[model samples]
Target chain A: LAKTTQPISMDSYEGQEVNITCSHNNIATNDYITWYQQFPSQGPRFIIQGYKTKVTNEVASLFIPADRKSSTLSLPRVSLSDTAVYYCLVGAGRGSNDYKLSFGAGTTVTVRA
Target chain B: EAGVAQSPRYKIIEKRQSVAFWCNPISGHATLYWYQQILGQGPKLLIQFQNNGVVDDSQLPKDRFSAERLKGVDSTLKIQPAKLEDSAVYLCASSEPQGGGGNTIYFGEGSWLTVV
Candidate 1:
């Protein structure tokens, strides 16, 4: 399990773009970067995942540098509904049963209306 | 398809009492995990099971906590002589078998427990 460090909290207004960076200096070669969003009273939901470079989906984009020591999650046009705690996890690639997934304190993003 | 299912959405018990939580994973998911989340903190993995076999339980408090997944379908987690610190949300999650590109794990609404 790779330890990850991220901001404790971030503030953003509607229609603004929010970027949260996570540092995993000890990330392994087989590890993948994944981001999850968790709203109050609900479980964390998968937002995006990537091995390297950049990966985009309907909700967000993940940008991983060539070194893969850190990654960024970017959300475009934020709204109040997007307010939640976002977790960044670094774990082995798919099908690796030995991987032990862990979670950090996570970055809480408060989207203001 | 339905998501993970957990029962006893809320539970309140006195210290030294016993409590149990049940979980039903998504229809074909082979991997199941139990996590504990304290207020203002991230979730901690307590146990993980792959098709009724224990995968990882190094974080689980073996003395007071025990879990089992019979028949590899439904699972149960039990806490005996619960302490105040045991008061937290118990979350159940499941993911597909190892392999393929998508190994995304899905979680269920957690079961909130309060130890008085």
Candidate 2:
């Protein structure tokens, strides 16, 4: 399992773009980068995932460099409802059980008016 | 489709008391997992079950915590002689384990346990 490092907390206002980056210096070739969003009292929601390059979804975009050592999660035009903790996970592609996720202290994003 | 289900959204018990939590995975799902989330921390996998068999349980506190998935459907996690450190949200999740597709896990509204 690869360990990830991210910011502990961040503050942003509505309508602004937010980018949270994760560092997994020892990421493996089979490792895929995924981001999850969790709100108070709710289960973590999958936001975006990518193996390399850039993958964009309706909710967020994931950018991974060629080395696959780091990835960034970009949320556009955020709203107050987006206030939550964000976790970055590096694991094997799909259901590869060799890489179990160990979530670190996630980065809590506070979206204010 | 129905999502994963968990019972007893909240539980409060005194130290050394026993408590149990239940989970029902989505229909047709073959893999189930239990996680413990302490306040201000991300969820940690306590155990993973592929159907009725245990896949991984390295993080589970076997001394006081026990879990079973009878018939590979609904499962129960029991904690005997609970301690203050055991106060956390117990989450249940399920996923497909048959093959290639990225099996995004679905989680239930976790059961919160508070040991006084």
Candidate 3:
């Protein structure tokens, strides 16, 4: 499994844009980058995922460069509700595309109004 | 659709006691996962199951923890002789694999356990 590195914590004001980056210098070729958001006392929820290039959805966006060594999760118009711990996960591929995931200490985003 | 369901939202047990948590995955989800999340840290995968078969349990403390998915639908995880460090949230998640194994997995609210 590729080890991921993320900032321990980040702070943002309301209506700001928060971008959290993760570095996986040894990410595998078949591995995919995924992000999950977890609020206090709840389970982690899937935010976004990407292999390379940029992927966007209603909630957030994920950007992966050519090297695939790093990725960033961009959240637009942050609010207090956006306060949560964000996890960047690298899922290794098995014989098939399916595989297990292990998470590290995530980046805690504090959105203040 | 109904999301993953879990029972006994919270549990409190003393050291050397036993406790169990139950989970029901979303309809037709083939993969089920058990994760332990200590406060202020990300969740760690304890075990993964695919249709009543164990896919991985490398991180599971088999000496004290065991999980079984019967009929490939509902599952249960039990902890024997719980210790203080075992106090954390036990989460159950399930997913239907998408192409390239990137499908979003849904998690239940979690079973809060406090082992004193």
Candidate 4:
């Protein structure tokens, strides 16, 4: 499993854009970047995943550069409901018995008024 | 489609006390996982099960933790004598078989445990 590093916390106001970057310099070719979001009492939900370049979902966008060493998660038009802890993980493409995923201390994003 | 289901939404126990959590994965999902999430930290994998067999458990504290998936559908995780540091939320998650886009995992609302 590839180790990942991300910010501890970030803050943003309503309707603003929030971007969180994760660094996985030792990422392997088979590793993919996945992000999860956790609200107060809910389980962490999958946000977006990307192998390279960029991938956008209904909720967020993932931007990866050519090096594959880093990736950024962008949330547009943020709302207070978006306040949550976001985790960035690097792992082998899912469902492989060898893919033992690990989660690092995530970035807690606070979207205030 | 139904999501993963877990029981005992919350638990409070003393140090050295035992506790257990249960989970039922989505129908037909073959991969299940147990994770521990301490306050203010990310969820950490404790064990993984492929069907009724264990796949990974290196991170699980064998001295206190044991888990089983019977019939490859429902699973149970038990701590024989939880410590103060064992106070954390136990999460149950399941994923479908590997597909083109990588199987995305779905998590159940965790079982929160507090040891005093």
Q: Which stretches of candidate 1 lie over 4 Å from their true place?
A: B97-102
lDDT of 3: 0.91
Instruction: Kindly list the per-residue Cα lDDT of model 1 for residues B2-65, writing each as its tens digit.
Output: 9999989999999999999999999988889999999999999999999999999999999999
Report lDDT (Cα) of residue A108, candidate 4.
96
Candidate 3 per-residue lDDT, tens place, B3-116, comes to: 999988999999999999999999999899999998877899999998999999999999999999999999999999799999999999998767645666789999999988
TM-score of each: 0.97, 0.95, 0.96, 0.96
**lDDT per residue as tens, model 2, B52-105:** 999899999999999999999999999998999999999999877335534567
Show how many residue pairs clash in every candidate, following the order shown: 0, 0, 0, 0
C-alpha root-mean-square deviation, candidate 2: 1.5
Which stretches of candidate 4 lie above 4 Å from their native place? none
lDDT of each: 0.92, 0.89, 0.91, 0.91
Winner by lDDT between candidate 4 and candidate 2: 4
Residues A62-111, candidate 1: write the lDDT tens digits. Answer: 99999999999999999999999999999876677655569999999998
* Model 3 pairs whose backbones collide: none
lDDT over C-alpha atoms for residue B35 of model 3? 96
Residue A19 of candidate 4: its Cα lDDT?
Answer: 98
Docking class of 2: medium
